[model samples]
Target: MTTFDKYPTVIVSENEKDVWEGSKHIVKQLKTVALDHNLIAIECYPGIDVKKLYHDVIQPLNADETIYAADLFYNNHTITEMIESNLTEDDVFGTFSPHSLEEFLDDKKVKAVKEKLKSNQKKNIIIYGMGASLFSNESLLIYVDIARWEIQQRLQRGMPNWRTNNQDEQISRKMKRSYFFEWPLADRLKKALLNQVDFWIDGNDIENLKLISKEKYLQGLSQVVSQPFRLVPFFAPGVWGGEWMREKFDLDKDEVNFAWSFNGVPAENSIHLQYGDCKIEIPANNVVFYYPTELLGNKVYGRFGREFPIRFNFLDTIKGQNLSLQVHPTTEYAHEEFGAHYTQDESYYILHAEEDAIVYLGLKENIENEEMIKELEEAEVGNKDFDDEKFINRMRIKKHDHYSIPGGTIHSQGKNSVVLEISSTPNIYTFKLWDWGRVDLDGKPRPIHLHHGLESIQWTRDENWVKEHLSSPNQLIAEGEGWYEEKTGLHELEFIETRRHWFSTIVYHETHDSVNVLNLVEGEEAIVESINGEFEPFVVHYAETFIIPEHIKEYSIRPHGPSEGKTIATIKAFVRV
Candidate 1:
């Protein structure tokens, strides 16, 4: 049995001294803060239930007046008109919005709310909602934050987008609106207001809320970058799901199957901070937003700003089905169509595979692009079963095989294999060409994007080019006592580089002024320690992904506990210099 930890937490403190739990305790803290400040503004992320918040915290506090930021926003129709370009008619894809949160507000209603706040100066006033903090900076600012994964779950449960009534809307459409329109605007505002926030609330769990002071929150973030840590991994089921994770990770047996595990994608994962016995969960992206320089290094921060450019995730097809035939938009196409600065250049590192497992890669030699596109279009409409083997290259794969897939190169992972997908963070730009005539778990036909795929596919990258440039060959780079390192590529066209290390004793590593993500691919247990005693020793098990911040210049890893004195291996990914 694999001892894979699903909920990994960073130990910020040994005792719980500054954390508050439950609504009653949270309300008591707010009541005390309200005594000194005239306005207590509780700014919320979208998908938060502000009405339930009013009943639990504001109503119990007995404030003189409560102002909801939702009331001051323009009507739903007006908001739709303002963001129509961003929320395109497409069900899956939308352009990123350039507008700010203030653009969505009604100036007249905002002015009126300001007048009301001034008139009630003598009384205790509370303002709470999405844009509550826009009224004043001097108010006691409390930010209620929920992770993107949590918001996605709420969307699946029929939660409407902010200030929009779409409870009956398809989940994909709702997610598109949030991703392109609401989330970008909200994240910009959140980053701008992060330093000004006085308190932070973990609103992921409605019944049980966790509150931490700004001092404690910053302290936790600072402690995180100083050491090797793991984010809380989230699992989801898909139409082509698998049982590897369900059985190995001891997941819920009732779940149909686990298809994907977001292990190192900070944007979609949460970080758990342990203070004594209390554990508070916050979005992992908060670390990227606040400590971009410390966490991402000067060079990476200069290039990507606050975005965590690289992603590490799992795509499980073991005992399930093949993924859709897909191609990611090229750099120029992604920028022109989706407002993305970069495209998804990815690589698949096979973690586990059955004997007959295969991977569908670039097109076959001398295949006609027009003919392939015509067949795909016809197959999409249920006219005939698409002959995949005729045009696409199929390669037999086994454990530890790696394949590089740059944008515009078609690819798919066949059934009975578990793939560790490392790529750029622009994950939603995949233009799926075909789905083998399979419907989604909802029994609805999956959406196909043959038009975009045709425009983006690189016809030149056929079998010859794929075999020559995409298949990774292990090239030994360095060797020391009891250790040897090999370059286990991400192709030269990709910005990320990968290295595999096999060691029986200690292996030294430096960050090279860039953040590094690693997984123990061939080890039962290992320990990572700071070379200069900068941080404590961190233990990891097989198949667990962990991050080493850019500032940790020097560290060492070796087999530990039961695996000590035994050869073990790890695969590490970092930005290319």
Candidate 2:
């Protein structure tokens, strides 16, 4: 009737190297398994990649096994209850060796006969684990094959068309996702477990986890921690799947992240731990949307990719495709004209391109009121009838072609070209001023929003914008040691910047004061660093969000194994003034 009763507990050491070796022995001993070993209750270790562990050790041994990363479920509840409900004060204890779960189900263990078993027989041992699903190569091959096809199918037929079938192959997927794998809902993970959805370790060195921290304490905290981060939510048309996002986490708009309950259970998060504690709450809009919304329209994947909150989408048009010449009202204009607005300022930081890739920035360069009105009428009709005309002036674009679209600038990605549009969250409030007859897959022409488009259009076209948008981005002494540094003198000190951030096996140092919003335009690194001494690595992707807070500079980021001789491109945006 105490914290340690009812089960034969095996507390492994909190060391990776020790755990890896201990694992070889546990797999061999578990063969004499009984019913209470039924739960095979497992623990996750820090920096341990569970998937790889099973691949090398468990599958070949052919034993039932389970694995969990303390990080992902650090905010999960069912996992906590699953662990706590099984614990009591009278349970017998053992290390990573020959232990018996028989004590829990009321069975007694026979005394040892003082004979030692061979540890290095090299026999094929049976391995069992919760993470077994991802460990076996056979299972991964099947999952990956199906996933690739799924992406292909959605791309070719379009998601909308796929949704109209009662006999859709994804119906089983729906049944499955209905219970587990849900975002914005705690029960999602619960359902996943109920559905027997097995997850494995997703990194290297995971082979050494069970031997590390036997700290069942963090597992206890995993249930109560506030897993806060911003997101935007939505669903793709024709598909029942929805996406969620929390992009604009205004200091004014949010209080608590969109709260969720899991597996028919209430959140175990203490009311006091809501938003104030953990000195490192990533920028969340007081909402717990599982991911970002699907707004990146026109063949581009939308927002839900980043684990971090803020991400920048860069679009560069190569050919002369009239960029559905749409305009966006400024934050102020958005409210007055459309009745709703958020922090939506987008810029076109253009690079090299052909001359004909005329990016129709705003209205034509230098024209009259009559001309503006006349162009609008013609542009609208063209979009209706699919006519390509010279309604907007063409910028003779060349190499290093650039433009800054601060909200109201009407721009589009032309065909056969390239561009980098550094913009705010892709919340589509684009007032389409013009598009020359674009049709959907249904053979129907897309509707053009003349009224909204015109309201947000930047009427005046200054001929010298190319000069204004272009800046010689340079580097200054970056604030922190080991931090990437490059200073520049462009727009009144802090306008726009393209920075180079690298994983310095050579220069990877530490910093504290300044925060860098890195847009990984170049390479990738597992940015595992500590905010207040807690360590976890959120991946830095090609097109994803990753933030290093101002205070948590005492952290280290090492490349994920193959990260030896690689370089990456990053566009850093922050207030220098």
Strongest candidate by TM-score: 1
Please give the lDDT score for candidate 2: 0.34
The TM-scores, one per candidate, come to 0.99, 0.42
Tens-digit lDDT track of model 1 for 84-166: 98888899999999999888888899888888887888888888989988985688999999999999999999889998899
lDDT of 2 at 92: 17
Off by over 4 Å in 2: 1-311, 314-322, 341-343, 349-358, 382-403, 418-421, 469-517, 524-533, 537-563, 574-577
Error of 1 at 112 (Å): 0.9
Task: For model 2, state the Cα shift of residue 181 in Å.
Answer: 26
Can you give the lDDT of residue 8 in candidate 2?
15
- Stretches > 4 Å off in candidate 1: none
The per-residue C-alpha lDDT of model 2 at residue 464 equals 54
Please give, for residues 100-183, the per-residue lDDT of candidate 2 as tens digits. Answer: 122111111111110111231232222232222222221211000011122223333322111122234333233222112221
Q: Give the TM-score of candidate 2.
A: 0.42
